[model samples]
Target: MVDELEKAKPIIIKRVKRKGHDFHGGSWKVAFADFATAMMAFFLLLWLMGNTSEDEKQAISGYFHDPSGFQEKAGSSPAVIGEGGANVAVIEIETIQPETDDIESEISKNEASNKPLSEEELAKLAEQKEIEKLKQLKKELEFLVENSIDFSQFREQVMIDITPSGLRIQIVDKDKRPMFDSGSAEPKYYSKTILRGLANVLKQVPNKLSVTGHTDATPYVERENYGNWELSADRANAARRELLFGGIKEKKIARVEGFSSSILFDQQNPHNPVNRRIAIIVLKRSVAENIEKQVLGVE
Candidate 1:
C-alpha cells in the first residue's frame, strides 16, 4: 500500500530544455559592429581636430554653418579638407555675413580705430617698414649668393653689406677675372649676367636704386681726351642699360654716378683689384629724399 502511494504521488520527471543566443540570429553581432565603427569614427574626429590649424577649424566650422557663404580660389588644397602640399599658402576663409541688423553697430564699433596716425607717426612707421624691407632684401640677396648655382663662380666677387644709407651690393673685380675688359666700359658676359639677375630680383621691390661704377687708381691710356672719369661714367651707364634690359624700369633708377679711384673699397691700397667695383645701393627713403633736396637746393 505504501509503495503504491509513493509511485502515484511522485512519478513525475523534471526535464529542463536548453536555449541558445542563436534565436536572436546575429542581432547582437550587428549591435557590436556598430559600436566598434562608432568608436573608430570618434578617434578619427579627435585626430583630425588635433592636426587642423585654428584658422582651418574656424573655416570648417564656418563651412558647416553656411556652405553658401564659403569663397576660395579654384585648384586650392582639397586632399586633406585643408591645405595640401602646394606652393601657395592656405586660402583665407571669409566669414559669413551677419544676418541680424542688431549686430551692425557692434561690428562698426569693433572695426573703428581708436585714433588716426599723425604725420610724424606715419613717417616713423614708414621708416620702420623701410628698415624691415631692407633687412629682408639683404637676407634674400645673401641667400642667393650662398645657395644659387647661377652665382656659384662669382660668389667671392659679390659682396653684400648693410650701410648707414641702406643695403649695398658690391660686385668687385677679382685678381684673375675682372668685370670689364682692360680700361673698357663694356662688361664681360658673366658680369652682364650678374647684373641682369640682380635686376630681375630688384624689380620686385618698389625702392629706387643707385648704381655707381668705380675704377682702380691706374690711369686710362686708351685715349688722350678720355680718362678714368669718363670710363667710369660710361661703365655706370652700361650697367644701367643692362639693368633696364633685365626688366628694371627707367623710373626706378635714382642715381647713376661714377667715382674713379675716389671712393676706394680698399682705402689702404687704392690700386687693388677690389677697389674696382660696381656698387648698387638700395637707398633709404629719408636719405634719398635728403639727397634730392640737397641736389635741388630745397632744404
Candidate 2:
C-alpha cells in the first residue's frame, strides 16, 4: 500500500508559465494619452481660428509675433554694429512720414487732416484764449468796480493787471482806510465789501484762485511764538475764509500764501503802506497743473 501511495504522488510534475506582454508594461498607455491630448488641443485651435474675425486674427497674430508692444518702428530704434560685431541699441528720432496712396494711408491722412491739435499745440492755444479771457475779465472787473457805489471810495486802492501767471488784483492799504486793523488779520468793513464784490465777479469764471498776504517792513515784537510769518499766514488764511464767505467755492482757492515783507509792492520803499496788501491771482490752467504735479511729488 505504501509503494502504491508513493508512486501516485511521484506522478505529479511542476511546469513554468509566462504571459506575452510582460516587458512593454503600461508605457504605451501613457504615450496614447499624450497623443489624445495633443489632438484635442489642435482641434480647439482650429475651431477658434474658424470663428475669429479677421481683425481679431490679425491682433492675435501680432501678439504672438511681437508680444511686447514696443516693437521696433522704422527710424525709431536703429541697431548699431559694435567693435565685436555685437548689436547695440540706439534711438533715432525722425519726423513722421507724410501722406501716402495706400487705403490705410489715405484713411490716416484724412484722420491727420481732421485730427484734433496735439497736446502742446492745444495747450498753447488754450493759453492764448485764457489770456484773452482774462483780459476781458479784467475789463469787466474794471467796469464793475468803477460803476459800483460801494467801491467808489476804494477805487484808487484797487489795481488790476494781466501777468504771465494770470490776472492779478491787488488791494493796497490806503492812508485813510486800511484793509485790516493794525497788526491784525481781521478785515475791516470796507475790505469785506470789496472782497465780496470781487468774489461775485470771480465766481462767474472757472479759473482757480491764489490769495497771498504781504506785510510792511514794520517790525513786530516776538510775543510767545508769534511773529511776521504767523501774522502773514494768518492774514492770508483770513482772506481765504472771507472769499469763501463771498460765494467763491472753497475748492476754487488753490493756494493761500504769505510773503511777509519779502515781495514788496513798492520796492523803492520797503516800509511803504502799499507793501501791506493782498493779491488775488487767477492762475492759468497750465500753471495750476504744474503746481498740482509739484504738490503730488511727480517729476
Candidate 3:
C-alpha cells in the first residue's frame, strides 16, 4: 500500500512556466483610458467658463430660461439680455413712440381752420362787390353831371353800359369836344372833363380798369405820315395820362389797347360812327386772384 501511494504521487512531478500573453487581460486598461478622457473634457469646460464676458453669461442664462431650452442644442445663439438683466432688448417690440391724442387733435384743428373757399362762393362775392361799386360810381357821376354847367354839351358823346367784362363808358364824336384832333393824335378841351369824371369814379372802386381806343375804318390819305394805328395808340395813352391826373392810380390801370377798325361795333358796316370810341373797362377781380395764385405756386 505504501509503494502504490508513492507511485500515485510520482505521476505529477513536471511543472511548466505559463505564457505572458495568456496571463494579460485589456478590460482594466480600456476603463482607465476612458476615465482620463472624461477628466480632460471637464477641465476644458472650466477654462471656457472663466473667460466668458458678463453679456455672454447672461445670454447663456437666457437660453436656459427659454421655454424650449433644449432647442439651443442645435447650435443657435440665444436671445441677448443686457448687463445686470435690467436692460433687456426684445426683438419683437418696436421702439417708436406712439402719437398722443393731443397731437392728433391739433393737426385736425389746423386742417379744418385753413380750408379754402369754394370757387362758386368766390365768384358770387366778387360779382356782388363789383355791382355795388358800379352803383356807387354811377351815383357820384350823376351828381357831378348835375352840378356841371356844360353837362348837356357832354351828353351827346358820353355813354355808359355794363357789358360781360364789367363796365364800358364810351365817349364818342362831338363838334367842339372831339376826343382827338380831326387828323392828329392830340386830344381836345371837353374830352378832359369827361376823362376827369371817369377817373374820379374809377378811383373810388377797388376793381382794375383798362382803357381801350378804337378808330374809324376810313384809311387816311396821310396814313404814311400819321397812321390810324399810331393815332389809336396815342389816344389810348392820352386817356391814361388824363385819368392819372384826375386821381386814378397808375397801378389800378391794367393795360391800354389800341384797335384801328379791328374790333368794331358793327363788323358788316365799316363806316358806322358808333365804332369809333374810347372804352373804360372794369375788369373782374378773378384776374388778380389768378395772378396771385400763379406767383404763389398754388393750384
Per-residue error (Å), model 1, residue 20? 66
lDDT (tens digit, per residue) of candidate 3 on 62-130? 554653533433224233232222112211211111223434554466569995546674456446655
Q: Weakest 10 consecutive residues, lDDT, candidate 3?
A: 87-96
lDDT of 1 by residue, 20-108 (tens): 66747978788899999999999999999999855356546655655443334223334222222111112322212122343444345
Error in Å for residue 225 of model 3: 6.9
Q: What are the Cα lDDT values of the candidates? A: 0.75, 0.74, 0.64
lDDT of 2 by residue, 153-212 (tens): 899999999998888999999886889988789999889988977886687677789999
Against the true structure, candidate 1 reaches a TM-score of: 0.60
Task: Rank the candidate models, highest TM-score first.
Answer: 2, 1, 3
Each candidate structure's TM-score, on Cα atoms with residue i matched to residue i, is 0.60, 0.61, 0.53
Candidate scoring better on lDDT of 1 and 2: 1
Residue 45, model 3: lDDT of 80
Where model 2 places Cα greater than 4 Å from the true spot, the runs are: 1-116
| Model 1 regions lying over 4 Å from their true place | 1-121
For this target, which candidate reaches the highest lDDT against the unseen true structure? 1
